[model samples]
Target: MGVFTKFGVRLLLALVLLCSCSIGYESDIDYSLMPVKQGDKWGYINAKGEYIINPQFDGANVFTDNGLARVWVGDKCGFINKKCEYVIAPQYSSATDFFEGKAWTVKPKGAPVLIDTKGRSCFTLKNVRTVYNYSGGLAVVVDDNEMFRAINTAGETVFELSGPAFVTNFVDGLAAVQNMDRLFGYVDKNGKAVINSQFYGADFFLNGKAIVRADDMYGVVNKEGKYVINPQFAEMQQDYNKFLIKIGEQYGWCDERGKIIINPQFENAFPFFGANLAAIKMGEQWGYVNKEGKITVNPQFQFALPFIGKVAWVKSADKWGLIDEDGKFVVNPQFNDVLCSYRLFIPVRNYVVSEYFDVEGIISWINMMLDGNKVDGMTVTQTTISGFRKKYNLGEKGVSVEKKYSRDMSYEIYANGTFYENVSDGWWGTTTKQLPNARLDYVTIQLKLKDNENTRPLYDAVINALGGNNGKRGSGQYVKVKASPGIVTIYVSDKQIKDILNDNLGWSNY
Candidate 1:
């Protein structure tokens, strides 16, 4: 029983037999036992919507991580699991999803191949021709007549990227491709071009900037294709890390050195500048401003978001909560419908960015505890555990990660502890409270100092700009600040505090 407890008892017996044909299903945001019915033929329902797998399928799919699912039926596709079982065998009309285990189908128009969830196609490609999805291990073909290339299921190629004409999907390590005159460019999976190809239109690089359209307007570059800020703007967006461009449409934020420093009058705007805060929208309403643009989360939400870390996510009377990146409300809007779900399982501390500021620094340690505290000396404890996995990434603590840094130091503690102690200087863990005047104190440290050798490598330039594979947790890697075989530490039952709470949780970004 425990395939999610027989999938929560066949999803409580398929939502008590599809609560009357799943009538319009909308418990409010998070819609998907899926079974929307009517259109594109999708299928599968049960969170009381019943049907379990019925939708008939002409196209559409989901379920994997072993819970198979390829779907399609008539023209092929295959896979399905979670006791809906077919295990793989639907054949192929085209398919997708399986990730690290492989998946890609295609037959009707033919070109894709790479199979494995047991439908076999192996890695064909009939000369490539069209396919996307698959990252880091590479995948993004398109040759035999269409022309794009990016192989790696052993077919090798890793970078071909023909004339662009359309590409996108790479995100961050960059991938916008397009040409034949539609302009725009960005490659870099070895197809090289980093920022080359030129930009007539482009977007997606965020933090380090990128958003170009140039001469016709829109500006900012930095991912090395250089341009610094110029273009001019009419519209642009990078989100979260900032860069909300736009000019004729009225908006501002320049500082990668082209100057604007966030002024253009904003009818809508976003972009970063030494950071003081920002989220403007003006007239009809939208709030959050500072850096002089003024406003600051007062526009009153019907929808809002653009803050991360300090918090943001508005909407009001209709319900949706959280406000802080300075707008304050903390958690006010009241839940009627909200889902910000960001938990790479939370973990950020392990500074190795050397230049010697005494080897590590970015400390804010301010615990008085309680009112909701949670920050155990962590080098990692990963938690989002609220109301038992509240379904954001389908919860169950989904997305807990394990990457141990080589650079990039960020830790912001808030304590509530349960258990964790993995000593290794960088992992003594933190946050495990229950003290109403009891006794349980903690300390944590993360150091960044480089010149002892590698020096400010910026996470080794983010692992060579995401071709990834930084792998280095070894060679005299020292942090020796707090975590040690410590000194006086003892624990007795609850399976040694549930094996130190499964070695301090997972998923982290900071």
Candidate 2:
């Protein structure tokens, strides 16, 4: 027999035996299985409140679409089938609900890995600074270098992207991305810029339509970047085939082609569910609205959730109850909480950001250093300054130079300071002390630019101030300033010899 079939038989037999010996019984939310608390422990009970499984677990989650639920034993978590058999052992520190026959989990002090139904490890990803669950056969991850990438089931990189400044995730075949200009656009699986970056914000496409923002207004746009709905509504919502639009503070319903099916009248609204019915609020109470904007279920309850299989959970005067499509109470208001557990098997989307890094802070620090003047840490001498001046053609009259500090990938800056032979005089004749000779003080500074070409202007300005590097005289005493790929060294000490450096970047004293 299949695993679920065998477990079902065992569960039925246990329920029958328990019901025969129990004193009283009550039905659960869906009348399938109920949760009971006994002596501080929780377990599953039948529709009649009879024990299906004894209260042995510390906590338990609702069963998922894969017919398995997560249960906690003391401090550890494990998955159990309908018959209460361990499918995946409780070894991971934390885990998400299973998706596409696999689940993402984290080991103690280890990287995140994917595990199959048999608890077999697929592969462990490295440098995964942050990761999300799997969805559409891929997951989004940010590496240690702060680069965003998408990985498939085998942990292979499918594509590397620049950003998702506002909202982005693959839904159909396109994923939203934010360009360098902070505008939103769509990209295909191959990382090609499919749509031009123009919208202020956007969402994943559903039914060949996506919600987009333009001029601080929300509207629906097609895959071809054409707006089916005009950019006018303050809010928009999609439910199956209907569109919910809100103008000002009042809510209304419209079709996909920007046609208003219902006038803006209700105070609030929600997406439509079973039988084309939507839950809406009239004043302070909630009710159901149909596609024609007709009120079918009267507004009576304080709050009402969407229907499932013709039944829904409702609230009245701080009490909870269950109601049918005709608004008749199936379960009277009594309990403090009510749950529609029968239809709780919703799939979790994998394209989400769990942990985000502070990109702005790092950029700010780099900008600060570009504007700083005071230099600290390692120092240079006078003789070394002369060598730099001669090497880079600082002209006949030497000038004071400044070197900024910066770090590499490892966050460490390796500086080759100037050194010279030192001679010392003592009472016992004369001796030489091993020490640097020149007083050339060069401060290393790191400037992070979005593009390397941006340094060209600064380089030209510095070289001009130093009277040109090719033995050509320009102006200023301190000459021979040069800049290369990822580096800049200037030989100027006048401090007032015309601060030629641009104010584009902020510098700090190291």
Please report the TM-score between candidate 1 and the true structure: 0.26
Q: Please provide TM-scores, in order, for all candidate models, with all chains considered together.
A: 0.26, 0.59
| Residues 39-135 of candidate 1: C-alpha lDDT, one tens digit per residue | 4466665333344665556654444334565566677767767555677777666566665577666655344667676666676655434566564
Candidate 2 scores a C-alpha RMSD against the true structure in Å of 16.5
- lDDT of each model, Cα atoms only? 0.45, 0.56
> What is candidate 2's local distance difference test score?
0.56
Span of 10 residues, lowest total lDDT, candidate 1: 7-16
Best candidate (score: lDDT): 2
- How many clashing pairs does model 1 include? 42
Q: By TM-score, who's the top model here?
A: 2
Clash tally, candidates in order: 42, 34
User: Which whole-number lDDT from 0 to 100 does residue 104 have in model 1?
Assistant: 69
Query: Model 2: runs farther than 4 Å from truth?
Result: 1-62, 71-77, 164-166, 333-510
